[model samples]
Target: MEHPSNGLSIIGCLRPAFYDEESYLRGLFHNEDGDGYASDWKDGERLNFNSQSAGANICSTLYKLEIMRMELFSVYGVQSSISLQHFQDAEPDVLVHSSSEIIERFNEKGMKSNAALKSLCRKKGLNVEGANIIGVDSLGMDVRVFSGAESQTLRFSFKSRVTSGRAAEKKIQQMLFPRIQRKKFKAHDEGLKNLDSF
Candidate 1:
């Protein structure tokens, strides 16, 4: 997935919920800061390095943090502080569908959210060749993008949780349109450089 200027890894709508700071801290047990993994269950957050750590370790720790967050919510019942906005459902032609519902409706099928997400991405002038919508939650979506031998999971958060598909698409457009323009401008500049070489 393209990295937008807004810092989102991928674009998708999030569900509404209030987040508890204490619960979030409780879940953050990695490195010396989090719970140690020296137990029978071997369940804990272990951070062997910090921001100055190696790139690979940093990536691993980031994923570990995500796990910690889910554990916090599941075991501690910590809800996000963010709330969802109520909106009337729109026609399917206007928007894809309620992302949460679409995810559920197509759960049995592999890569269920692919089509909807692809449409959204394309609308924002993004490349969706190797992009996959791995998971969609109330908070947002987990989008996995593959580039050659490397892949990355990007977390995209929504400003508000929208009920209808149109609202979701509109929200994404608002968040991404500006960033998409920047990306296009950069690409065009690079193309111009190549033209000079030719």
Candidate 2:
């Protein structure tokens, strides 16, 4: 669902209990006549899909969320480290806007040979041929890997939290080109030391 105030899109499955109810009650937040629980939600639209495909998509989304939750727990020692308010209030547009560029750069950097991807493939014992970054956020990204007749979703965490898409892009660049990033970091450090001498 898209936030009424900010336009950040969040996708998740509605509970089965609300499946047969009106869209607004099912958390759609909008309806005809501009009068509903979320009257301010003006442009909410629902798309119907086959049960099988929808179920698969929901499963994939849930899996990704689970992985993210685990990562958060490991990092923050609490499941609710990031509250709902964070998502509601945070500016995700920058990250959303730069996702395509990040994906392109990742693919262009020879995704199949990425050490992280290779590690996942080896750990899972799967022969993945091609991989694509399907989604990215401040914390991490979800990558879709394709084998001969199977596919898998893998999660890669960022070294540090990024607020903007450009920052996320830089993080991915650092991951893909560690040597270049290290050299840049070294040069930056030298410059800082030179300034300290002044």
Candidate 3:
């Protein structure tokens, strides 16, 4: 059955405070919305993927999350973790040999919440979609999206990991209205600017 909120029903409402896994994933990798997963990975060697396929990194990440359970999920990647079997008996949902199912599910849910990220991009007139999210760190994330026929992934570094949805929305606003860049000077030169130089 589908989740009432249209997310991974398997891990339904186990933690209502951290509800909406899709949005959580999106926020986790909010950085990867516009590009492929691998290139943006800072520690590429750690991923240990044998194939360099289009969505391999994302697939690998999701696979690890499913297999390792929520305990070690945060250690691998993402700001938070959600155990699929938190409320039930432990059993493998998707095996390594056939990981496509888990990857597809991840893609579906991740994309569903991608709309919020896309809206952010649209307000900036970026015209991009949060195609797939690759990784999530404590501070920010990486997002994968299609740029024409090619896939390009970019990093979205946040000031901090969002603790709540409202906080996430506020952070997005902060991203939207970035601090104006200003010329820098030596410490001693800081107070030498003329009042009318503005």
Candidate 4:
């Protein structure tokens, strides 16, 4: 039953745009007279998880999204508030999930779609069998290749979160010293001219 994997079938690429960052922030925190703030978030906490507090904050954020049904599958690349129950060609498909056989079929179809999606996923050593890395993003990557070049695109979400690093003062010193040297040379030239008058 392995048919071709349609790139559009991978689904849900643009739904995050639906998220209201300001509202989300407020929902996380629920402030009184000011802005929304998540409970227990300390100042200077890392945005991505590396420490215990950072990890806890991320978990809190995910918990909130889950409560909002924001983690479900997409319908035609748009986020579905309900599970895959009411798609075209198959309003009945949604009604069928209660049956164990239908549920298994649904699950199998999903797994197959995921397997097709793995055609797009990549890490350091893992490479797509017949694809080219065309783009990268915060959460995932994209590749260009399919049996039909026009078919089967993939967006591979990262297994680990990326964190940003701040520049250290020592590194800044290395960059500025050369500029300082040029300025000092011009000052020395002025000083030599002044010494000529003595």
Candidate 5:
């Protein structure tokens, strides 16, 4: 899949004809028995060496799968191929450019801000100490939780849909700081009532 803002392409085969195909490819590029492996990508102007680090690899794989799942399946179970223009025409829940900032904000607040996320983590026996947001959309976000040497991705859904980055930010803020937002809303309502009384 290609990012609209950047010309960079993420190439991966989601399904292999044979089950062993994935293991074979992984062996070639990520062999624990070997001296490790390296992958490179070049776009004429720049050559980038892809790291085989555990965190990097997991993030890349999760991102690819998430994008594919969102693009291929409209409502999770249903699958359909969609055109790039059509996908673009439908406003994405979270804008690509704003994703980084949103993720950063969520990280800064830590897991304490989101009770649902914290509860889910506890139910799954995941350690929220080093957890972080890897991917997010209007529906929810993919959080990476670490436990010892292992890591897993957890999907945390939002209460409602967000069409733009601003909306997503507001939704996240409301989720993260419910009491503050409620007070702000209450104050605004009171101010409006006062104006009406005048």
Candidate 6:
């Protein structure tokens, strides 16, 4: 069993309660052996790793410590592939390929943020490729990223209020809900040279 208060190794998405192949990658990177482990065939004939808490395990602490929190209230909203901007100066013209515009924009801008956001994102290792800053609203800012691929997003909510410094880490940890760790398989030895240790 993992010690209490340790963070997750498996990456999880709250909007879509699911785990994919990438979870394994998260497992290998965390604990070398403690958290990641292979199970017997009876245990679903698969390796085993830890699971994330269903929801925020330390929300109270977060609220108290993080003066402001950027909760991703919603995400991954997709629209129809067709857009009027893509067509020529007339109607029913060739539909524009969504990806073409993304490439074009990247050419104009380096696909990076200004000095401020860039510094913050770098501290968090954010991938801001193919992003567009539309406008600012009550939600701080309206932005989009990754025109076609697995378009990821980021929302920053900063209230002037003050919170406990200690709580900030846990708040971000649970919200991000980072990737989990996995263990390796114990294969049979090629030779029977040593039963002596046993």
Top-scoring candidate (lDDT): 5
The estimated TM-scores of all candidates read 0.28, 0.40, 0.27, 0.21, 0.40, 0.22
Evaluated against the true structure, the overall lDDT of model 2 is: 0.54
Output candidate 5 Cα RMSD. Answer: 16.0
126: Cα error in model 2, Å: 6.0
Worst 10 residues of 2 by lDDT: 58-67
Clashes of each: 12, 0, 15, 3, 0, 12
Stretch of 10 with least lDDT, candidate 5: 1-10
lDDT score, candidate 4, position 91:
30
Q: In candidate 4, which residue ranges exceed 4 Å CA deviation? A: 1-76, 79-130, 164-198
The segments of candidate 2 whose C-alpha lies over 4 angstroms from its true place after superposition are 1-93, 109-127, 180-198
Give per-residue lDDT, candidate 5, residue 161: 75
Estimate candidate 6's RMSD in Å: 27.7
For candidate 3, report its TM-score.
0.27
Tens digits of lDDT, candidate 6, 1-198: 101111212222333112343355445434545543322222432333343345422211001121121222234333223222432244421212322343234335442333333444545676543444332222233334443455555554433221432233233222222233111111223233355456
| Candidate numbers, best lDDT first, in rank order | 5, 2, 1, 3, 4, 6
The RMSD of every model to the true structure, in order and in angstroms, is 19.7, 15.3, 23.1, 24.5, 16.0, 27.7
Off by over 4 Å in 6: 1-118, 161-198
TM-score of 1: 0.28
Report model 5's TM-score to 2 decimal places: 0.40
Superposed by TM-score, candidate 1 places the C-alpha of residue 159 at a distance from the truth, in angstroms, of 1.8
Number of the candidate with higher lDDT, 4 or 6: 4
